[model samples]
Target chain A: MCTTCGCGQGEGRIEGDEHPHVHEDGGGTVHSHAHAHDHAQGPGQRRMVQIERNLLEKNDAFAKINREQFVQKGIFVLNLVSSPGSGKTTLLTATIDRLKPRIPIAVIEGDQQTTHDADRIRATGVPAIQINTGKGCHLDAHMVGHAAERLNLPQDSVLMIENVGNLVCPSAFDLGEAHKVVILSVTEGEDKPLKYPDMFAAADVLLLNKVDLLPYLEFDVDKCLDFARRVNPRLKVIRTSATTGEGLEAWVEWIEVGAHSAKVIRGEALSSPPCRA
Target chain B: MSLMEGMLRIVEENARDQGFGHVRTVILEIGKLAGVEVEALRFAFEAVADGSIAEGAALQIEEPPGLGWCVECEKESPVESRYDPCPLCGKVPLNITGGTQMRVMALDVE
Candidate 1:
């Protein structure tokens, strides 16, 4: 239900039309009532109005605001996107544990419904907020902006936004992060990158998680990396396994470098105004 | 159809601004690389346009071919996806010049 206006979605409202009714029971009691609507839509009433606006413009506008805030605060924000059961949450938990002692950290977890992931992150002793995007297949920039408002992120901290577990819709929406880390597990098909080329093309880095399971599975790690590169030549890839703690240090090092770079860049931007900031 | 929802919002807002009573049709210019399925969009318009000024509205989509700029060839050409190497030079990366756009073009309103 809409808070400002009672015209909630799914419940149709008649704002400009009305249908009135009256009835007299033979007992001399008369009743009158009216419901809104007039369904006589004629062909001649329709007129053309030009719009010509991009569908992603609204979301991108909000993303720009979030990006500016992150740059100002010097927070290294990484948007984690992947298909369901790709071990994003597990990887996040492991990474947080490895880096929480050295650098301040916060998390914004996105899921269709449940605080399950957020609960796991909190157990690791870092502040985490869960955004339940009910009926929303993906998280937009506006939702992330509202979530960031309440996150109370510290300066020079790392903000990891665990995006909803979907590869298609999340590929188009930018949540204003320094990098979008797309995680693909060995369990999934190596042909996934070729099938979902849009997701691979949009990603800055592709994480091949669950590498520990490579020996047991028929998944060809090299072939998958080649497919990812074929889609996006500039994609930086890292192999990791959250369960066995393999490649976890490299992932942490990667984030630490990003966080440190964000700090220095933000400092330089402060001393001299950013060129296009 | 989140893209449809975004387009519908703009359509309805434009109707309100123009003092139109209702919308009859919405014309969209969807590029090939917009990552939207034309069949799915036509089906989803029935659901996303419900309860708004565009309820029961007709959706007319115009699809444009995907266009790309080849850095090696220094020419613009048509390509399906970013994964496709440049047709002219067979380059690894061809910068996208067009397509991948979902926009609301015009609305037929009352």
Candidate 2:
């Protein structure tokens, strides 16, 4: 209990203000108000409002709208996340080079401040939009929804969202993608999945990139895979290297499978009206 | 920080709906496996809630322990980390059952 005004319980503290409930009482003496601020409802007629809601409720709502839009458009969206210098862009460019010729491909590049990634994607003969978050760490669904509108995405297309190169924040913000592909490079520690378990847990696929450098470094591939599985049993992993073109074929095939399914679902939806609850 | 913004929005919306003059307390329920830094949220909450209706409102956080259901044991047990095995029987991967939630449970208003 706070010795002072007893405003907060044991844990809560007023940010900058020290004297919480001191009153002069129109006299020279100053005293603190003795109000019951306990776990239960206080006696001072203060109401205890019950509001059991999630912190990401607003973001989740926006993501749901984006998901519906994507499903309706037959757009197979993938949110790619990784640490800085983990070859997210390199892998994306390589994957785009292969998939663009077959399907209508679009890119949404997210970074703190830069049009560099988007420019790189456009050079591949595909439309790409840059979402510079300024000081924001991650790209939210609201931003992606607006970007998708600007892109005017095509049906039976593949939209690859290269998220800001930070594993922590991106895992929390869902962009309504069909799957979240986490890129972990051999250049980094093998224990990355253990250190950042939430990203590994949330990710549907794990792209272990830069596998060409595996022989030179002390990076334990087996240990890395084990740790990733420990965190997420269902994480589909693909050992990839953009430089050597090792796993690009499998990656492209995976995208194709998802895109084909989305197209089929969209066709079915169009043929039959949506069931009303 | 955005989470804090979400928290304030929720409080403000409640205040508008419930006809509350001021919010005196905000109680949050954060789980152990929610991947949120409690200290960071607490430090950021003061600044985020400043000059708003929830300004000076005491922020209280309740952390629920992580729980996982073990296939070998066929029972739920307490866990500290995601990699931890089942306490009863050593299992490689225990299915997560609880403690991944982050929410606002209640508020004290006047």
Evaluate all candidate structures by whole-model CA lDDT and list the values in order: 0.78, 0.82
User: Which 10 residues in a row give candidate 1 chain B its minimum summed lDDT?
Assistant: B8-17
Q: How close to the true structure is residue B110 of candidate 1, measured as C-alpha lDDT?
A: 78
lDDT for each residue of candidate 2 in B1-110, tens digit (9 for 90 to 100): 76787787788777766777678999999999989999999987998788887999999999999999998788999999888888888886788888988899999998
Worst lDDT run of 10 residues, candidate 1 chain A, spans A20-29
**TM-score of candidate 2 restricted to chain B?**
0.96
lDDT of 2: 0.82
Return the interface RMSD of the candidates, in order shown, one decimal each. Answer: 13.4, 12.4
Which stretches of candidate 1 lie above 4 Å from their native place?
A: A1-46, A272-277
Give the DockQ of candidate 2.
0.33
Off by over 4 Å in 2: A1-45, A275-277
